[model samples]
Target: LTVSVVVAAKRENITHHQHANVGDLSSAHGFHTTTSTSYYVTFLVESGDRIELCVSGTEYGMLVEGDTGRLTFQGTRYLSFERI
Candidate 1:
């Protein structure tokens, strides 16, 4: 599916997790950290409706706010955006 829309906004969400291990007196202690990131884009359609969709890092990088384009998708999945 495709729709004509204007790029409204973009956002990124990141989450971090930390793990710690404690050993006996003969051993050592250590800490490990992990992070996860997600990207999303918001579009304004001709009907004046705004829709937010989760996108990949590459897709997010290619989109710019206030850009007008054609958004191609399958259901809630994001495919690509072609600037008009």
Candidate 2:
């Protein structure tokens, strides 16, 4: 899937940095994406910085199955972000 993390000093700002696409979910955890599929974005910011999560693509396939190899196409998804 494709995602972006935009940060700016004001709400009117639209500047952003495009990151690479994330790969498939991990086999160990059917609901979680691979650990290596994370993005590390670094930029200058102040105390009142504004960050946004923007998505513009399909996160799953047409016929995704469950861990048991059954036809289960509905589940939960998550995203994680950490400041260094």
Candidate 3:
């Protein structure tokens, strides 16, 4: 997955980073599957900094015969900030 730290309103991308294959298949049933993953970025910033987390993926192809289906992602995602 690709990650970026962007400044709100300005829409300026401060950093462009990527983590390849940063996910796992936790469970699967029929054409449905469950995935879990985590990511973190260590950067210096000020308080009230508006950072956005954007995640996107691309589909290569499918295996089922003559079956065309689209993939949907829906889950709970949260981000916590801390100083170190």
Candidate 4:
């Protein structure tokens, strides 16, 4: 519980960061991506597990194959998300 709270509090405005391929981004042609810093409380994650985006502050249900994701940035974009 404490770990979860810490992680949740750690989030701030997302930084438009790197271009790592969203490994499980879906394989269909009509995939739509959402944005939000909040991840589902139920989803268990590990290193290298593809973290799905939820721009609407919800949870990731599932992902399709072939879908791709990349964080974008411009000169004036947020930098805190600088992916450590």
Candidate 5:
């Protein structure tokens, strides 16, 4: 599905976690760290409705705030965006 929209905003979320490595009992190797990043975009549709969708990192990079485009999505999943 596609909708004509204006890019309202963009945001990124990052998370980190520490895990204990039980096998390697040494203090230096006792723990490991992991990081995760997520991206989201908000759009203003022709009907004056606002919708926010989670997008991929690459997709996030291509989107610019205030730009008008056609947003393609499936259900709540973001597919692609094309500038008008």
Candidate 6:
């Protein structure tokens, strides 16, 4: 199954930000430089866009192949992992 979400206007505040670990990486490059802490990106869906995704869509793919959840955007862009 497919899910479609509609976002409302003037609700951009609903968008949010998040971070993730990016593993170890050298930055200094000065003799014995220490590893630096890196962060990845995450999403905070808010409004203005439509999101059509399956509920079973995550990292491990779809569980039942037809389960979906629609998260209507109000003022931000809709972003998420695909189901299949």
Find the candidate with the highest TM-score and give its number.
5
In angstroms, the error of model 1 at 53 is 1.0
In order, what lDDT does every prediction score? 0.89, 0.26, 0.27, 0.28, 0.91, 0.30
Residue 62 C-alpha lDDT in model 4: 28
Model 5's number of clashes is: 0
Worst 10 residues of 1 by lDDT: 21-30
2 or 3, greater by lDDT? 3
Residue 8 error for model 2, in Å? Answer: 12
Better of 2 and 6 by TM-score: 6
TM-score of 3: 0.17
**Inter-residue clash pairs, candidate 2:** none
Quote each prediction's TM-score. Answer: 0.83, 0.14, 0.17, 0.16, 0.88, 0.19
Report backbone clashes per prediction.
0, 0, 0, 11, 0, 11
Cα lDDT tens digits, model 6, 1-84, are 223422221111123433332442543332332343322222223343333332222422322323333433333333343432
Candidate 2 residue runs with Cα over 4 Å from true position: 1-35, 46-84
lDDT at residue 28 of model 5 (Cα atoms):
68
Q: If ranked by lDDT, best first, what sequence of candidates would result?
A: 5, 1, 6, 4, 3, 2
Q: Model 3: runs farther than 4 Å from truth?
A: 1-29, 45-84
Candidate 5 clashes between residue pairs 3 or more apart in a chain or in different chains: none
Error of 2 at 16 (Å): 28
Question: Per-residue lDDT for 15 in model 4?
Answer: 39
With a 3 Å backbone cut-off (N, CA, C), the pairs that clash in candidate 3 are none
lDDT, residue 33, model 1: 82
Per-residue lDDT of candidate 1, residues 1-84 (tens digit): 899999999999999987675554433576668899999999998999888999989989989999999989887788889999
